[model samples]
Target: MMQPDTLTVFYDGGCPLCRREIATYRALKPQGVRWINVADARPAAGGGTGSACPLDRAALLARFHVQRPDGRMVSGARAFILLWHRVPRFRWLGRVAGTPPLPALLEGGYRLFLRLRPWIVRRAVRDKRAAPPG
Candidate 1:
């Protein structure tokens, strides 16, 4: 299997809300990351696709997940923190999140995000496929 340094962001490509954020991330940070859409995680692509392991689409869509080099899986706020820490400018947010209170705070915030996630998900599903980055 091919893996890159740092983090791999497995997101719901079908989610407009998610894709909008991904699009912003793509525009702002151009290094130190590989963004993988759950829809694109086909077995032929060497990424987890089917209901095996921790990479299936439905599972991934439920939350943000990051696969570390050591094969550890971090999800939700921790996953976002790992990812935010990698972005050039937003790395500080990750640092802050790693702090005791901040991660906890983010977790609380993540719960809220999930509470509102279904509404967000519906909006995202309504979004048209965006142009792939050049």
Candidate 2:
């Protein structure tokens, strides 16, 4: 059930890919969706509470996470499922993916991403550092 109240999502702000994806979602201004940076455990510049999800910073940063209305914390594909429900544009995805078989598939993919995340972050950082400042 999508709560009209708020969904606190914890993400890795330090990761370029994570930042870009979150920025896209933020641009939509999804209803009741609060973005938080795991790196600092602070609400995004947009809005929300500074301390919402009471979880270890390292665990939150290690994977995608979301704090449900009931205060239950979910991670990885499950977290994304919670997130999609909050965003109108992606609600369908949340429904379709929530069903059997789909969740397993999504979780598998998410796990793969987790394994590659470090390398991806490193490459992005290297590229950014190499770019000549304008």
What are the runs in model 1 whose C-alpha is more than 4 Å off?
1-4, 43-53, 121-134
lDDT for each residue of candidate 1 in 1-134, tens digit (9 for 90 to 100) = 54456566788887667888888878887466767888666653434564234655666878888877666778899988888877767788888879998888888899899889898776655553453546
Clashing residue pairs in candidate 1 are 16-124
Please, what is the TM-score per model?
A: 0.75, 0.81
Error of 2 at 83 (Å): 0.7
Q: List RMSD in Å for every model shown.
A: 5.5, 5.1
State in Å the error of residue 134, model 2.
8.9
The local distance difference test score of each candidate is: 0.75, 0.82
Which ranges of candidate 2 are over 4 A from the true structure?
1-4, 42-52, 128-134
TM-score between model 1 and native: 0.75
